[model samples]
Target: MISFINVDCTFGKKAGIKNVNFTINSGDFVFLTGPSGAGKSTILRLIYMDLFPEKGKVSIRNFDSSTIRNHEIPFLRRRVGMIFQDFNLLQDRDVYENVALSLYVSHYKTREIKNRVYEVLNQVGLGHRVHFYPSELSGGEQQRVAVARAIVKEPVVLLADEPTGNLDPRVSLELINLLNKINQRGTAIIVATHNYALIPRIPNARLFQMEEGEVTKIT
Candidate 1:
């Protein structure tokens, strides 16, 4: 459902990618593995349209980076979920409210929003943490909150940018397993991580090993 055709995007002093080409079908589990400045996160940003390619194009189902308008980006984002190394939860908002905000922005009804927020929180094993705030939860629990927030929209593809960067190994594995379960349910997953150790934990996942600013290997 996603395709990157000879995509080349450059920005800042170190954040960029070059000639990156790949296709991720629905329900596929893919990993972008490389060093600190390997451009993994840039790829994810391109997928969600937070970054645009200067050369070639990124195509995600209906949206194309080269031709997409400003107004259409929001619709593309609703179909693409994102998680980050830092759990980006609002300290002022409780877990339930944080998860509900996306649906609220999408104009889902109050009842539907409540039901979906609860459903995805439960799916991420955080059902009881609904009333908890970001500071009250552990690092792992907070990340689970982020996961819940991302999936509440039932996105077509989920992009995780070093999602386990702050968690311990065990909690990281648990998070990966949770993501695996979500993928099995038919949402494609693309994780941008530097941890090569995580690759073995995921079965049958495609590996896109990047170097400098290019995809040097895919296994």
Candidate 2:
């Protein structure tokens, strides 16, 4: 449901993606693997329209980066979820509040928001920590909160950049397994990371390797 056609986006003299082309179908699980500056994160940004292509275009369903207006970006975002290496949970807010904030912004009813937040937190294995602050959770638990926050809105596609970068290997594997489960339930997932070792853990996932901002292989 997402396509990047001959896309070229550059941020500076030596940083950005070039001639990147790919398609992610619905319910698909894909991995973007390469070293730093290989344009993995750039590809995710393009999908979410955080960075418009300098040439070519990015299309996610009906929304096209080439023609989408700024006001419509928020609507687009509601269908796409994103997580990062660093858990971006609100330090002062409890887990329940963090996940519910998205629904609140979208003006969901209070009862519906409560149900959705509880369901997602449980999906991420954090139902018991609903009232705990970010500081009270472990690294993995905090990242689970981040995942819950991202998926609470039931996004169509989830974009995760270096999601396992901050966790230990065991915790990273657990996180990957959790994401795989989410993918199985129909939401397409695209993860960008440099961890080749983790790729094997995700069976049937398509792998796209990059080098110097260009895709080098698809396996």
Candidate 3:
């Protein structure tokens, strides 16, 4: 449900993505892999409309970056979830509060928000840590909190940029497996990572390789 048509975006002297083109179907699991500076993150940004294309356009369902208004960006974001290498949990808040932030912003009823947050946290294997602060959790648990925060709103697509960058290999594997489970339940997932070794773990996923900001291979 996402398409990038002949997209081109650049930053200063560094090349962004050049004439990049791809489509991610609904409920699909895709991996964008390449060396550093290969534009994998750029592609994710385009999908989320965090960066506008200098040329061409990015379309996610009915919203088009070429014509989307700034006021409507928040609405677009409500349908898209994102996770990062560094867990961006609120240090001052507990896990429940952190995940509840998304629903609160969307103005969900108090009872509904409580139920959704508990459900997602349990799905990510963090039900017991609901009241724990970020400092009280391990790295893996913290990332799980991040995942719970991203998915609590039941986003249509989840974007993860270097999600496993901070964890050990075992934890990375667990995180990917969790994401796969989420994908199976119907939310499309697009992960931008440099870890080629992890690609084999998700054998059925679509693979897109990039080089110098252009997609060099797709499998």
lDDT of 3 at 144: 93
- Clashing pairs in model 1, backbone N/Cα/C closer than 3 A: none
lDDT of 1: 0.92
Question: What local lDDT score does residue 219 receive in model 2, on the 0 to 100 scale?
Answer: 77
C-alpha RMSD by candidate, in order = 1.2, 0.8, 0.8
lDDT to native, each model:
0.92, 0.92, 0.92
Please, what are the lDDT tens digits per residue for candidate 3 over residues 70-93? 999998898899999999999999
Clashing pairs for predicted structure model 2, backbone only:
none
Count steric clashes of candidate 2. 0
Score residue 204 of candidate 2 by CA lDDT: 92
Task: Give the alpha carbon lDDT tens digit for every residue of 1-219 in model 1.
Answer: 999999999986544998889889997999998998889889998999999998898999999999999999999998999999999999999999999998888899999999998889889999888999999999999999998888888899999999999999999999999999999999999999987778898878999999998999888
- TM-score, candidate number 2: 0.98
Model 3 scores a C-alpha lDDT of 0.92
* Estimated TM-score for each candidate: 0.97, 0.98, 0.98
Estimate the overall C-alpha local distance difference test score of candidate 2: 0.92
Query: Clash pairs of candidate 3?
Result: none
